[model samples]
Target: MVNDPHPPLHEYQRSGDYVVGGIVSHAFILADSIDFTIEPPPPSLEEVTVVPKNYQHILALAFAIKEINENPQLLPNVTLGFQIYNSYFTARSTYHATMLLLSKLERFIPNYICEFQHDLIAIIGGLDAQTSLYVATFLDNYKIPQLIYGPAPVMNEKTPGLPFYQMVPKEDVQYMGIRSLLLHFDSDLVTVKGDICTGEEKLENLPGPFFEMSMTGHSYSIYNAVYAVAHALQAMSSGRLHHKAMADGGVLKIQHQQLWQLHHFLRGVSFNNSAGDMVSFDENGELVAGFDIINWVVSSNQSFQRVKVGSVDPQAPPDQAFTISVNAIKWHSWFNQVQPLSVCSESCLPGSRKKVKEGKPFCCYDCIACPEGKIASQKDVNDCFECSAETYPAETQDFCVPKDVSFLSFEEPLGISLTCSAFSFSLITALVLRTFMKHHNTPIVKANNRNLTYTLLVSLLLCFLCAFLFIHRPEKVLCLLRQTAFGLIFSLAVSCVLAKTITVVLAFMATKPGSRMRKWVGKGLATSIVVSCSLIQTGICTVWLATSPPFPDVDQHSMVEEIVLECNEGSVTMFYSVLGYMGFLAIVSFFVAFLARKLPDSFNEAKFITFSMLVFCSVWLSFVPTYLSTKGKYMVAVEVFSILASSAGLLGCIFFPKCYIIVLRPELNNKEQLIRRLY
Candidate 1:
């Protein structure tokens, strides 16, 4: 009788006879048990039969109804009845069942709000997702409460009249539970297959048929749905039967409007079930607890037992949401009980980077080596970075090593050569100074402003000594003193030559009696010339120091593999100003001496001053282009070479002949020999 087709309308009418309200439940009992093609040629009605396991969903609903009826606290003095229907898992059958619940008539009417049977309060159970969705469309128009007991269907539109609620969690929660189980066992590669159940298959040897039941998820949903509906009704009744005024003979009638109030009441309902598990619904009418994860482990006898592995609770915090027993999971025998690799490509090694494969996921990529001068220290790096200027990539391109600190140190060949030359030139200047002091009273020594000659020799000695500052790693004091000292000392040297040239012109003109130039031919004129010319250079150096003085700095960008430590002339303008002033003195001295070169004096120093100034200007003019073209320590070397070469030119040109006359030819150095040669 239970396996027979749905009983006539009289059977369902009997359910409403002694009940104050009716709750209808629909299940796909017959259709789910049969094997049929999904595409062409629909199966005939004769091919379908109810599987006993699938009928458990209907039984669960029935148990809830019986439980509610027995509870005196829920719906007191009234019986809550339920009508169970077989939806056959088809849209047509589910729609017909909804129409039957709506009205006893055969024909359907659109916008049917008025209930033919006021005893029907809420509708529950459409175990198939599509069937539930189809039934929900019509029930929503009349503001009916539809409690679905299956995978929650996605509803795009909301109708005010349809208050649909779901007892089961959404399908995504189930997927999450399955994903957590797979991740727990570290099983990467997995195979999945699905089979349809035929009614002819024998379930005798199966483990209670519950494990093999295709609608097991729906059965559990139905179990929860029954308890949910019972609780909702109990909350609505509040331990009393809700009824209107007596219709006849003290029998009370329930209004359709009053039954619709269950929709609002059910939304706020929450309670613990028989298992002490809390059950509640969110604002979307979906269960909040999500799903329970079950692992089906195959036993040694080839029989399978279900193990509770974990649960996915969406309401909980993310870290506490998906809990699982990782050790309890059992993998397939073919996998050799080890985790499998699931990536599309192996990971990139150190010194290599990942190149993502086009039209593929991020997990799939190609490994490429890092470019030259760049390195990837970590494995699977997406990009490589370049080394700093003072560092270089290692052989494997996995790390950067610091390059050696380089400068014009005194230990190096170039630095040693420049130092030796500076010292040698200084010694020669000292010798020349000693010779002039020894012959201080001689005619040739005192002829060309003797005081100015001493000043020039001292300045030349200092110029040679300043070259030593450029031979080592620059310090702050060295940087400040190097250029400034070079400028002032060279200025004094050129100023002395200018004074001598002027003295020679004045001495030649003062020979005429009563000439005004006689007064300017003394030591006062030469002293004033040297003092005033040197004072202007001292002022320029003072301004340069006050504004933007030079400091020690390292050149990291100029050289690829070395840090060149040198002086950074803080202001190029001031640096060139110093050089320009010195050149100005040299040029003026050269012109003066050139004009006075043919004067009638045997001891004329004009030709020597002109040649010395020419050499000074030539060396400096060439120094500019050479200094600008060089880099690193070579730049310092070029400047040092220029200083020594120019200083030596001035010393040999201006003072060497005077030394020769005073030391080697002492007879010619007397005043009589000088006056006789001049006349």
Candidate 2:
């Protein structure tokens, strides 16, 4: 069957060929394009197995394929199909299914792509981390991207480069919680470990002898994934055939793009999924770096009583603090960095290093290190330690032979050579900038020079990004970094605005015959004013933090984690404080422009500043409300909008006037002509 490009959709009888975008597509032109019929490219494998039946992965994949087939006018006439096999439980069963899929794919590969020329991508489902690991490797061998709706760290750990992507919290993050719990508990001599429960029979049956004695799994993760996907697909579906298909295609493609850019597919996209808080992955594709740890106590009857553990919200909220209990449970952990020494002392006795022995004092045991040049991440007394990268162990005794650094470079976890290179790069950039400034003084001297602004803005941007990373998902060192970066950027921006205002005031006052401030208002005054403004803001911030200590809450409202910290951006007072300062500058600049209207028309700097302020303020004012209204990726988008708009305003004000004169009034290029025209 072929679809006509100009088919009268209203008159055409409903058929299997078209899928609508929504439940009420009859009243809406949901689809705006034409569909074409191209054969699906091919399937890498004929029979692919989905382990543990991840509802969301299946749902998303199903909708994606359905959409490609039914897009109105997109592929005017095409049919796409998929074959799904379920790998219910256990690693052994998962392995069996993988082999079956492999065998079938071998037979279908040559013809599948040609037969289905239009369908180039295949989505495999594995909300189960263990199972997905096996499936991801299988798909990676074929150069396909597998969207795993499972934990992040598991996928990465199992196959780091196997093209496996995730839309859930990573296991590394889960470990973050575990590690935090261990540290917090040990520090205070609290003898308890957090347990995980997944509400699955298979997980329930799995033995826990090898891992942490306190670790267990729960069903909340699986539940959340299932319902979240269902909600998104439900919203995306249409009752009509054509529109429905188009929506599906659009959503799938958009989601892929978002994931590629390191955003979470569902939560990060700002899709409502009934999660308590609107969940979204951060820039690293991690929804939450730390989970709540509940200490489990076994009663005499064997019933477990789980006490609440501390919550780690990177952007902590007000009123939540580092506490031991919340809502009936004692929080045993909050994510914070544990020193390598805390885990095991850096200095060890002659015959022993650091090690963990399951049955001893807080699980501490002695570890032995071999003779010089030999290293291992883990070592226990009496057990032979494996040699670290760059060294190979000799069969005879506890000694290591060094390998060439080049050969060991890629394999080491923290490659020594690469670390040194990164440090050098930073040093070089700093030295070059310092040298340039020393040689070219105008950049430092100019009050509103474009070169100066550019340099400052670049540095400010780096500072902003660094601040984000420093406190991002807050652990130990991040706290200090976050605060410092925030203070620095706030100071810089405020200082810039203040300097501009002073420049305007001084320039206007200079027009008067007798004004002492005018004589003092040169490059030195501008620099001094800028520095003073920055220092003032910094002082205010420091005082506020000292008086009302802030905790870390990932969300601005700060309800999830019980520990909010003082940072540059989270507080309402901070927001208003900065806004107030900027607002004052804007008002003064406007006033200066109004007064300058009577002055010689050649002085249009005030007018330019006024224009820039209007745009800048409008952008920020609109941003506050929009930012407050959104939770995840959409909130992030609002910030992006504010940034882009502010930049555009600055660019227009700086360039638009010059562009007008050059392009529209070339005759005014001459200084005499420009002055005469302005007058």
Candidate 3:
């Protein structure tokens, strides 16, 4: 049945007597030339300009049917037939054509008796999206299969009882083809000028008669639709014939109502087409295939030629989806063969970030330099990041460089000065020890327990040497030795001072009658004081090392541009405990020496011990705030300075007077002078 609504129904003809199937195709014939100046856009009911190439789709469909019918293996003992129709490319005309195909009556009434029995197995035309949609609504009610040759609109909530399959790929996959073409030509700005149905006249004057004009996607879709239907029918027929031969050895049953089986078989069908390309359908009944990208190359004669430059395969992985042959693309004359940039703004360079513009595409952004201490290593970074703890940003803020490691190194000026001072003080202490040895028998030398004085001088020498440990890059061994040695040795020195002060008081009291303090005025008491006080500090240090010992570590957080290699005090409480014990000994010695300074003995050394303890306490008291306030290597410098200054004070203040008496006032060193002063 030919569904032409015009008066000239010359192309409409009945099917052959042995027809087994039907085909519906839209071929518009121009009745009159349309006038563009007509108002109201020419009534929707009027005849419009017709395209002659639409007939090529019809011919392609007929050729496929002919090829399948000639092959005995495809549909044995069966033949295919067709009923052509012209939709006039309009919704209302396509609806009337569908009504006529379903029933011979002029008007469509649901379940009405028909004048003729039309064995229409399937309907496969209506190339326009709107026309197909209108036809699909009616055929779906009766489960008639509709094969569309172009992209169909999404179906509404109404159930499509029949299978409505589209032969072309979806719109998104088509856009991928367009994008590949743009990239092939290196054209950033693309203008899509017309609708899908409108053809460009520039494609005319091609090589062959069939290629006289550019073909739309609908033409290729029609070619594939014919092959798809043929494959489904062959599979259905073969199954039916096998079942009949196995069960009853009878003729195969082929009923028009079994078209639904063909629909189900088409969903899973896969085969090769005449072009040697695999054809199949997705779950949504749309063809699964890649899109071909076409580029228009302009020649010197002002003629354009279409070239295949690329393709986009939606079924491929994301990275390999779109590919193009860039060398084959021909740019416009104005480009001078150079590629064009199409972004909304210039790309952000290195060391700068991209700030997204509001209400704009991702390609449009503002370039911003990275902030201080932060870096953007890559181009067009969304935000800059801060450098790592042990690193610092370079001058350009494009790289992160490792920070310079710093410590109180002996090679530097500060370390050199501290070390020289320590050696100088140590030498002075040695000189004082030598002076005492020379004047071993002198009254002033033997007045303060001579053994205790020697022990104090040796400990002060060790204290001066311990400051060397803090002047260089701290190691684990030095970290453990410096504080422990300082604590133990200084304890011995202060304990000796306390012993001398006690001895002075005891000797002064022993001069009276029946004084019992004479028993304690010997070396035995002084030795016990030094040993017992040092043992307590030694115990504290042993426990401290056993539990949480200090270790060498890098101080990254203390300074921004430098990594300070220093000792990490493992336990703050234990460290302070050591300092507290030393402070306790100093305070006790200071008070005892202060009380005993006015004793009535010409040989009393309490005045010197009192002044030495006062100096020691003052140096250390100032050390705590300075050590806490300073940072990095300077903090270590302050601690080392305090150690040297305090040790020098003890050595100078307590022993300098004795050296003066022995060297300059040698007359006062005799026992006769001491006894005369006592009288």
Candidate 4:
């Protein structure tokens, strides 16, 4: 046991039978220097400074008891008294103060009774956790109720109860608490009209620099703590008086043994305060209350204003728990009008995806755009996906757009040009064939095997018509005939030129003396050449259709934003083989026509045949590289254009002069004029 030589700052007053205990930290100590020696000087007022703000806590306790004593509706017959001690903010002083409340002065014996009628009911603890802990530990054995009127002790579940009870709620409750919640326990202090400040009147004025030394956060808690003890004691005394169950009691008498019963009454106290808010406690002795959400705005003059912005209610459903009205918030001018992005990495926008950074947190990432032909439907997606077969990725890659039906159609500009060219050439070929038929008896028309001429012109007409197969929507029949038909038809036209070349050579030989080549110069030899060369190409197309034929298919990869309805050649080898065969026939005809160009006979036309073959080969030769370089439906257009150009080349090169003579120059149709040109 220790004895103090100097008197400390302490206050005590006896007014009634019941006494309440208080331990408040009214002053703090500052040791100017610590003496490291074994014996140190005792703490005194020379080292201690009183806190002006903390005087309000002790004042709240005094005012609460005064308000209760003056209220007639509450505690009609009972009066309450109190003993307050300055804790000096030290655990040793706090515990020593708690002992004085239990034992009488000059009697150091344990369990000594009070010398007066004042019986200690409960203690309002010191303003700090460590001080309250020391006071509670000393008072627990006696079972006296200790109400903590300070900040709630931060204790975990396994921390074992430190303070006897709680006044404020746990710190974690404020994260999800109600708005505008406080106590009415000390709001009437300013209206108390008389000399209410006691010895601390200098610190009691409102709107002053020290904030009137008013009831702060902890002071409010102290006010509520005092009201709680008063309510519990009144209820306990009233119960005994109303039931008349107190044996040997006229009104209500509280002994040291029955003080523990006040814990039960205080634990069950659930009345609403004057603020219309419930001053209730849960089973764990935590205050059943809430917290208000405030936004701190610092103005230009450095004035701080707290604005109530939003709230979070723990009792509400999860989606509705947190509610905010953004328009109510006022932002500083330096922040700009829009709220700035403050995240480590902003979320990836649409048309891009999140790429996690190596060796970094998950929130830290890089954003990359979606690959071509793919789309991301929402922001922060991990990867982009391809659209359905009938759709394509939009330009932004944020969504999929429906694909347009694409092919070489007659309505579009390219289609209209190809269609007009094909029909114009066919009409020109038909007219030439008709002109030859009407002038069959003439010498120029009868020359160069008229039957072979007719066969060649008719095949060229069909070749021009073949270009229509590449236009419009591709079907099963159209796809089958599109490539193969053009190959076989062009082959017939080339073979006719070959036959006509052979005929001119044989007839030139027959004009020699006693030549046997004249017997092979009739229609039999010409027809055989046409049939044999055409049959070879016909066999190739037959094998193509029988083995790997063309079929209608949609091409999505060839174009970024379209689906081309085209013919997918089943076997690329066979399709090339068909084009190769036509090239071979044209080559053979060009060689034959070139050799016989100088033949002097009047009927020989090998020079015209050579020029037509040259035109045909030039058109198809340039078609290959251009066709390979282009994408989508443009590839089909190139092939169609090649067909039209080559057919027109053969028509113009071979028959333009002949038609000029027959229609415009009638004298050139005579034997004399032909003989003059041939010589």
Identify the leading candidate in terms of lDDT: 3
lDDT of 2 at 253: 30
Q: Model 1 TM-score?
A: 0.53
Pairs in clash, predicted candidate 1 = 140-162, 143-161
TM-score of every model versus the real structure: 0.53, 0.30, 0.57, 0.51
**Candidate 1: residue 562 lDDT (0-100):** 80
lDDT of 2 by residue, 74-193 (tens): 333333344443343345444444433433232233224322222223334454456666665655555443444444324345467555434445555455544454444433222333
Superposed on all Cα atoms, the candidates' RMSDs to the truth, in angstroms, are 12.2, 34.1, 11.0, 15.8
Off by over 4 Å in 4: 1-347, 354-377, 382-390, 676-679
True lDDT of residue 273, candidate 4: 61
Question: How many residue pairs of model 2 clash at the backbone?
Answer: 69
The CA lDDT at 465 in model 4 is 95
Expressed as tens digits, the lDDT of each residue in 1-679 for candidate 1 is 1222254334333433111111225421111112211111323556434232344555566566566567766544545555455444456655665776655453356657444655535677554556667777877765677777655556565624345687656556555654665455433232221111123221122222221112235555565666676677666555234343333344322333355676776788798776677778889887766555555666678787776656678778878877866566564454355443433677677799999889876556899999988999887778999998879889999998898788887899898999999999999999999988987887887777677788889999999999988887789998999999999999999999899889888888998988998878899999999999999999999999999999999888787678888899999999999999999999999999999989886866788888998999999999999999989999899999999999999999988888887778888888788778877
* Residue-level lDDT for 481 in candidate 1: 94
How far in Å is the alpha carbon of 300 misplaced in model 1?
A: 19
Q: What is model 3's C-alpha RMSD? A: 11.0
Ranking of predictions according to TM-score: 3, 1, 4, 2
In candidate 4, the residue pairs with backbone N, CA or C atoms under 3 Å apart (3 or more residues apart, or in different chains) clash, namely: none
Q: TM-score winner among the candidates? A: 3
